[model samples]
Target: NSILGFQGNRDLALNMINWLSSDEDLISIRPKDPADNRITLSRAQMQGLFYTSVILMPLAIVLAGVSVWWRRR
Candidate 1:
């Protein structure tokens, strides 16, 4: 299943099924270490992202919709 790109708790479901069926072999494969690709932003950068995504993008979409409606009408 790990070959299919699923990385977390793959054997957990299988183990649970085995336990339910009273199977003796219980698999306990360790998890792979996650890659360090975390982002670190300053307060100003976070605020900019918040405004752009939460406020400005929606406002732009609404404005475009209104413009199209006005032109069509």
Candidate 2:
């Protein structure tokens, strides 16, 4: 399950990057359009980002606090 989720996410991320980096026109990428110019992210992607922020932000704050404490020591 985890591996499948990872592969699905990897594919989604790749598609997003491809769409974002493409040189196609903006209006051509709308939902009503016929071109495949838009990429979609799954709920896992959203949750992954949220979880990453939740974990990393506090870790960064702790690291910064430690750095300040060490400097003052």
Candidate 3:
């Protein structure tokens, strides 16, 4: 369980870093002015997040519940 949780967290962190690194607007060499607040998410990226969260969250919950139930039994 601990190993699975660690791997899940690592996967999420890697995905976040990859997404941030790939965003051209977010990786400006010159720091943007504080007033600039433009954020964009492409359709595909939004869909990916939606799907990943929807799928992974439930799977994680189910796994956790089963783990607890197994331990109690």
Error of 2 at 40 (Å): 6.9
Better of 1 and 2 by lDDT: 1
Off by over 4 Å in 1: 1-32
The TM-score, computed over Cα atoms with residue i paired to residue i, of candidate 1 is 0.55
Q: What is the lDDT of residue 64 in candidate 3?
A: 100
lDDT of each: 0.81, 0.68, 0.70
Better of 2 and 3 by lDDT: 3
Give the true-structure RMSD of model 3. 20.2
lDDT of 2: 0.68
- Candidate 2 C-alpha error for residue 70, in Å: 0.8
How should the candidates be ordered by lDDT, best one leading? 1, 3, 2
| Ranking according to TM-score, highest score first | 1, 3, 2
Model 3, global lDDT: 0.70
Q: Per-residue lDDT tens digits of candidate 1, residues 1-73?
A: 5554465455667777778888847756656778999999999999999999999999999999999999999
Q: Model 2 over residues 1-73: C-alpha lDDT tens digits?
A: 3663443565555567667888334323323336677757799997888877998888999999999999999
TM per candidate? 0.55, 0.38, 0.41
Each candidate: RMSD to true structure? Answer: 7.2, 15.3, 20.2
Residue 54 Cα positional deviation in candidate 2, in Å, after optimal superposition? 0.9
Off-target runs (Cα >4 Å) in candidate 2 are 1-41
